[model samples]
Target: MKKLLLFVCTLCWLLPPAQAQTGTYKGIGTIVFEAGAPLSLIKGTSESANGLINLETGKFSFDVPITSFQFLNSLMQERFNDKYMKSSRYHKATFVGRIIDKGPVSAKGEAKVTAAGILTIHGVARKRTIEGTLVQKGNNWQLITAFPVELSDHHIQAPRLSSGYGASTMNVSLRMPLSPTDPDPQQIVAVKKFGFR
Candidate 1:
């Protein structure tokens, strides 16, 4: 009896935690920055953003490659990668946080949501809480949010020569249409159409 009980306890311990609901979506994400002063506003977009979510635990994560952002001007793109963002040094920016849902998040209607987590950019991590909207349409989930980012918050410094060029704060926004973890044929076709591999 004692041996059986020990074996059962060990088996239970090794089992994974209960995930009542889990889903994933592969889609594109974009970022646009509007400078305040003598600088030209820049808008960059990426079709390489990916997102993961756990509805049961209210956990979520997103990742975007630094090199994926494409600027309107080729020279600006080059400078952004080499000088400002330093893509070689810091390859990717990521956010890992949890959703703040007071009640169960509806899989059918739109819900106002907030997420609190650490955002890592240029190798600097800062705690941030962002508000957004979560909407479920058919078999898809869309997360949309827009917020301002301060350059000083992430230790991003502009060159002294161009000190007054770019804005001190940049407005950032994201919209991701996520599909199921195990996508069906229709979902796979949709993912391909979005230009994601």
Candidate 2:
């Protein structure tokens, strides 16, 4: 029995590493916003966005801390967090969705995909479908999407203190970079069998 166990252990060690599996992957990125009237451009960006994606299931989720958003004017930033966004009550904005890729996403190419999911902001959740491009360069994946979000839909009240800040729709852009999470046994098996990164 001991000899048999030794043989099995040796066989396992001799096997190649398993292929990459499709599972939960952690990533960090940014969410940017450009709003105000057509003539007026109000832009702010936040680098505290983090996300996760499952390659096999196409499931994805993203979150951005509201306080991370930065503006050129510190006063505007303060008001945006305390007065307009009310970040004290709602700390983060999040999106949970899946990528609709027509075919398998290549590990080294680019694909145009649409993500449909529920987005929650200011304590309000709404259904949203956003189209974006996914590019895989080396071991990293980048996702970029731009869409218009209506403040009224999320029940975000416009501040009367500044007309420059009020807008019917806010143009939002997302740029996220993701790395693979720890692979499972099955993924390891695949990696060993097929040598997938």
Candidate 3:
């Protein structure tokens, strides 16, 4: 009985049971930065969307959560919700694109790819290019994107710098964990027709 109990305890310690990642998942991400400074201006991720990651073909389809934009502080959040972003009308900012560089992520340590496509924000679709880097350890993948998107590109009127802030492109950061999902664009968002714009 003591031996059995010891074995059970050892198993529990060895494996972090619930912390393991899942297949066919929904990930939440944040975009934190100012147009020219570091501020949590935009934050959003999909609670429900297709996440079929084709490491082989360097293709992907995803939906950016429409209702997840929160401001840096409570004050900013209120201001953004009420005035700047007007989250109620212009819900989500979505993107649909494919990785340009294809490689066998069959086994990986560090891999980099460039994803260029369209970003629709506040009812406007504009061209954008962002670099994606992934660090894979076992079945888990850590992804990161370092890129800049100009607010003017999407026609986000910058508040006067004298009273507001000085910035043109809003710096963006995206991190997500890949999961097992269907490889179909039917439920997947269309780069040309996604309604998140």
Judged by whole-model lDDT over C-alpha atoms, candidate 1 comes out at: 0.69
Off by over 4 Å in 3: 1-26, 37-52, 102-108, 160-165, 182-197
Model 1: residue 192 alpha-carbon error in angstroms: 29
**Worst lDDT 10-window in candidate 1:** 188-197
User: Which candidate leads in lDDT?
Assistant: 2
Candidate 2 minimal-lDDT segment of 10 residues:
188-197
Using TM-score as the measure, the top candidate is 2
lDDT of 3 by residue, 1-197 (tens): 99999998777557542222122233445555455433423432333432444554445665555456554357655665556656688876777777776333434466766787777877789877777776665545556676777777877765434336545666676777764344242333322121101
Q: How many backbone clashes does candidate 3 have?
A: 1
Clashing residue pairs in all predictions, respectively, total 0, 7, 1
Give the TM-score (vs. native) of candidate 3.
0.64
Pairs that collide in candidate 2 are 17-192, 18-188, 18-191, 18-192, 19-190, 19-191, 19-192
| Candidate 2 Cα outliers beyond 4 Å, as residue runs | 1-18, 37-39, 103-108, 159-165, 186-197
Please provide, for model 2 over 6-82, each residue's C-alpha lDDT reduced to its tens digit, 9 standing for 90 to 100.
Answer: 99878866764322444455778888897766555566899889999775567888999999999987987898898
